[model samples]
Target chain A: MSPKSVLLWTMQAAVFWLVLFVPQLIVFLLVSNPPTWELVLMVATGVVGVVHTAVEPSWRYRVHRWETTPDAVYTLSGWLNQEWRVAPVSRIQTIDTKRGPFQQMLGLSTVTVTTASAAGPVEIEGLEHEVAQRLVVELTNTTQATPGDAT
Target chain B: MTTPAEVPAGLPAAPEFTEPLQEWHRLHVRMLVVRPLNEGVAMLVPILVLLFTGNGEKWRLIASGATVAMILAFSYLIWRTTRYRITEEKVELHTGLLTRKQLAVPRDRIRTVDLTSKPGHRIFGLSAVRIGTGQQDVPGTDGLTLDAVTQQEAERLRLVLLQKGTAPRAVASEGESAEPVPLPESEVISQLDLKWLKYAPLSLSGLVAIGAVFGVLSNYADDLGLHPVQDLWEWLFENPSLALIAAFLVGLAVVGLILSVPLYILQFWNYRLTREPDGTLRVQRGLLTTRSVSVEEQRLRGVDIQEPLLVRAGKGAKLAAVTTGLGSKGESNLLLPPAPLSVAHQVSRDVLKVGSDPTTLRLRKHPFAALRRSMFRHTVPWVVIAVGLAIWAPSWAWPIPVAILPFAALVGWDNYRSLGNALDERYLVTRNNSLVRSTVALQRTGIIGWRIRRSFFQRRSGLMTIGATTAAGAGVYHVTDVGESHGLALADEAVPDLLRPFLVDSTVDDQAERNA
Candidate 1:
């Protein structure tokens, strides 16, 4: 994960909160007799969303980390609830890189490594696009050399 | 659908591969008899209701007769069209008149072969064989089913599918008949004891059975012109007697106990676990609808010793295998019914072929911070509800939530007591939960991945939860609320060097390399 990931995360959070707020805001503005308490609740939601957008990204960036070795892939991610996951090379089933619209704009990509077990998937988010591609190729080559059904 | 010509010229012809390219065989002719009888019995209730309740209309009689004829014809068509065969490479089924679906599973992927003989099938000496490959998410993709085959044939298929590369047994000759040959010598791991029936009531299956009986009775209450439940409710309301209500509850409990004994006898009348000569663990149970479920020793990942609250109070536990291909539904992987905890431990040890029971090992308990976290999680909701009721609702409602706090605290402490994890040489053991505390002993080699998680509160408390993911039962077994460093160390040790790179202050350890 890069330091720039905090900015990306903040932007993502803002977009998420905005998606929730816009509909309620539209209904409140357009509807003739919207409840007073609903407006109060909506305002509270806006305040919480703004505070969350301000605080959560930097905290998550401080917590998120990822590493890979010739033998395994390791990752620690999540904000309020953090997860540390490890998948071995011998058990690697597939490796792919995904770039969302925001990620494309920021020149970043997310690499996901999956194994046979449903519980074993290590996703490394907010990486430099070139670094993500190189990591995917490296994982593919190593996994090919490993021999097993991976189940 | 594979023709003999598809075998290319260059490859060596394996003997088993060349054989069993024989013919696609139809289900046993006796299935025509079994299927119609089974269908007729299922429709008996509705048909009787019409014949007895209708106003003697001629069309009602004609409709009942026509329905029986349709059932017979449909069953015959099904039997005629369904064809299955086992080749050296795959087990194939080509069935369905309308759709013409073809389903096949490679021989190597076959995981479990279940033989079930419902009463109708048993009457005709037939058994239904369900071949499962463990990939059950798809609707009709990998599994193959042969309904109502000759008992001998079902046994033969079971042996052939489970022991890959083995030549299938010859079909029974003219004199041998439909009687299944006795299985080869097997060592009995556990068998039903008469005393074990005492635990049946505590298992709570009887309560479910009683509830089902009430549900059916209520459905017919209007037809019968009687509503005992409604009458009882009215009488209770008129009298307003606490003693009467308590007496009714006691009566219900007695009925539940009485009902459970017979249900238990029917379900597990001759329950037995045996290890066959081929290294398959077989469970044979049920009186009327006899079932034989086999779990390959190779696919056996671990065992779960489950203690449901009521059953645990009676010092009993149920045991089930956590294996690949045997889906958890139908309790098909169950090794032991609610039996004495001692017997469960002994059987678990025997099944794993371990000298000692890993589930019974003394596990390292989580930190006191874990207890604090659990207590807060468990009791805080009730306390908040109480405070809310005090502010917004009537005074009596607040006392109700306040009254529940002690029980919630007890549950929290029980949950804390159950949380522990241990690593033996061969197995990684974990136990948790209060309602149905399960101690799982998973083979260390079976673990394919590791996940360690920390909530914001957990981070503040210096606690983390570790999950060991396998391809077996439930996919992942978690060790909740352990110290972060200890969890990382445990993960590293469970699968050598799998987590070494992630360990903060990593050191090159030669121990794992030497073990490998």
Candidate 2:
């Protein structure tokens, strides 16, 4: 993942955890005043957060190395384990670039590659507009020249 | 790109071809009439009930206004939806006055051309010309309606479109060669004989009755304070043995009847398969509203022959074909629904002209590796369901175990049976299916991508599922049952050989195939 992608993934994880746990915390505080079990649960959550922060450095390093590969582009990511798909520049049939509200706000674009097969599409998310356009042109040119090179 | 105006004009359009555009049958009016006639009575019945039982000027005014608006809207639609234009390069269809939507389909993309004159169209001397494309949409929805056209004109247009590509070549052939290959006239493959068509009219009626009964039952339940049937599902599961036995018998009977009915209708319903002069297959059917659909030989994907355990005793096997174009229904794209195995093979070889090399046929079966992979992916859910059910109700726990065995066995067998793949220099054929056996053949040039996936358990078992995706639709053909090594080898050999030219994976191609 790119540094930007790692940041996005981290944000997503933080948001997801907050959405899941924050309401429960609020409900507990409102309903039960200073309960020992609630206090213990709060402390456990804090410890988990600390552990997550501690592991972030190694994850960031791996993400940077994986994302910066010049040979292909990787899009999708996972939390504990990540799924990194790299498509060589030549295999792409069509490249569609899209900008959603959030991505547009952040000056990022999503690129979708359509292969001739029926397996649907593979998409790479969170690339700068100019970078995505350049990649599409480069891949299209390479694909046209070496059509048979894709596996 | 040439601008629309700058494009060079060709031959002169002769006097607007004053021939009737289509048979003068009022198809739109007929459709409008049927829906209202059939459903009007139901709508009016309730109103009539209210009018008799109670009195309200407000209701009367509302009903009258609604009826008037509906009539006006229908009339406006029918009046505005009249016009068709035929151009040299494409067929133009115009409809919807408010929106004035115009659809132009290039003659080249059209695989089949069908003309049908329903009773209304027939009486009006109007005919509807339906053009079928590889796109997934209702076949007859986009058609040209000619209000007045002679049979001769219809035939002329059909011949023109059918022989469009032959003219320049024909002239050239006349000058250079003494004998040009004559295009074959209509070659009838099979016909639905009337005897078979009559078997399941009663069965269809039975289904209608069943639907009506269910509707009434649901309506009654809604009227009363009872919950929907979903709530009663728990009661059925409470007695597992009784429920299972009842479900099995009913399901078997229903399935047997459902299958028999369509086959019966197809057997009788003018089900003639004819090969046109242009190497297109045309199937015409329906007693009341006779419909014809043509498919080009090039669009045919692959032929599938299935022998279900029940039908295995018979000498004949069911035949189906995967096509690039969707069927009239736009759901299942398989053509030649359950014909004889011999007919299927002949159609495959002669009509489709697919190569019969052992390599191609051998490549057709699902790789055994896929079976292990799919089994692993699928087993987790079944195990979870079983455990959940067992935990939910201890009394019914024994039945959960029994159900899981058959579920796993069936899935495993299906995954195993579905493995097969075939690839030729020109075409690729792969066969796979769980319940409905299917074989898909695709031209080598048409494939977009190839995918190989193996789960953690599948890797351990040395199995992987190989899938090929096509642009025609999102239906992927997968070879499911194979050993891991065999699967890997096949993927390594086939993906690069077939799709590499189309694939741009410079990184992986340079590196060796990953064993995992």
Candidate 3:
């Protein structure tokens, strides 16, 4: 995972909170008859958003980790709500590398490995772009070497 | 894996087909009678309305006759155009005149072959052969149906399609010469006992059925000039006596219980489970629309034992197969209906051929923190709601939340008690839920991947939910709220080396992280 990934996360969080914050901020500034409760709510939301934006990225950076062996891929992600996923190489159906606009700007990518199970794809997010490409190729080679329909 | 290549069992020894009839075959002529009758029955209400509204006019009779004739003509056209053929590699069906449609399911892909006969077809000794593969997202697209075939012919096709015989000679031709294999003996595993009917009324399905009927009626209540729910509410408002409302509820419960008895009889009149010599478990059931569903043992991933709350209270349970391509989940894979719990265990053991009952094995319970989590989880929300309601407005409804607190705690405690998981020799067993208690014994070999999830609360409590992802059953089975290390250990042990690379000692990891 890249150190700059924290910046990406903060940006994403800011964008999300901004959707709620902007209109309230506008109401507080522009409307002379703005409700007192509305002012209190807006300030409370702003404080939360700032605190989350500050503390979350670093906590997530410390928690998120991914590793691959010859036989399987293992990943642990999330700060407060952690998820650990492991998929055997023989059962892997597909491997994909994705780069959001923000991720691309930061030269980071997300790699996802899928099995036939509908549980979900195993995703390793915030890897350096070049590392993600290498991971995808490595997974593809391992899957091809193994025989049998993944399902 | 490819379809198991084995000796074709239950096939007639004498090669009936001397020449392979690769030619497309039309549906049985018997459908000509059945299809038109079915259409007429469907149009009966409209015909009756026409007859009554026409004031005994002769035109009404002629119009009804014309409609019947048109339906008969359409049925004839459909029968003529619909042609299905069993080639060596695929079962192909070509139908529809205006918009041509062709469906071909490969011979090897055939996972289940079911024969169904509604009263209309049963009268003429005909059955519909439904061929299903693994694909289930789209209902009709995943399966091929031969609307009507002679019962004997349907049996032959089922045998021919499912059996990937050692030598491929002739397909589903009427008189194709193929090597004759010995008929496989049918072993009866379990059959319905009249005493099992006692458990029928305990099932809440009757209440659900009644609710569905009410829902449909409510949709049309405006047209019918009836307002059942509104009238009931008005009555309750007028008479605020709790005893009357409780009595009414008791009456409704009685009605529901009585309704379920007939429904049970109608659905499971002649339920039977048998192991056909052909490596398939055949379930024969239904009183009205007789259905015979066959699940190949090769596709069997595991077995699931379900005990719904009411049914469990009565010591009754249901059994289902966790196999692939048997059709959509609940309806198709049910091996035993709500029967005795003992019978469920016995049938599960017989089906899996395991010496000991996997589901009944002793399970490791979740930690004490999990219990506290459940208590806090269930109690807090109601307390908050009560507090909010009191602050919002002082009302008679204050008692409602207070009264519900005990039940919520009961639910939480029950759920916590039900939380357990274990690893047997060949199956990883997990038990969960209080409302619909399910003990799933999934094959160790069938587990394709593992997912361990810990929410914010769970992380604080040192607990995690471990889910096993598989190709069969519900796709994922979870052991919820186990100690984090315990869950990791179970995941590692269940799949051998899959989770070993990721697991680390908590004590060491905590110290290292603190140092860093």
Q: Rank the candidates by lDDT, best first.
A: 3, 1, 2
Clashing pairs in 1: none
Error of 1 at B469 (Å): 0.4
Please give the DockQ score of every candidate, comma-separated. Answer: 0.57, 0.27, 0.53
Cα lDDT of model 1 by residue, B250-288, tens digit: 998898888888989988989999997666889999999
Q: Per-residue lDDT for B1-516 in model 2, tens only?
A: 111122224632221112223432333444444434434545554455445545666777687568746865764575457555555557666667667866766766665566665555554444455665555423345344443244444544555454445332233433343333444357777666444333353334345555676687676566455667767677666655776878867875686567656545633366676777566666666554555566666666555565443333332344444554443442233334344455556555655654562223665444445555556655767777777777776765646665776777676677566557766666666666554455566555455444555544555555555565554544455655455445545544554544233233423543556543
Specify the CAPRI tier of model 1: medium
Better of 2 and 3 by DockQ: 3
Model 3 clashing residue pairs (backbone): B17-B175, B17-B176, B17-B177, B18-B175
Per-prediction tally of clashes: 0, 51, 4
Q: Which parts of model 1 have CA positions greater than 4 angstroms off? A: A2-19, A96-110, A126-131, B1-21, B29-81, B95-101, B134-142, B165-184, B214-241, B384-401, B505-516
lDDT of 3 at B421: 94
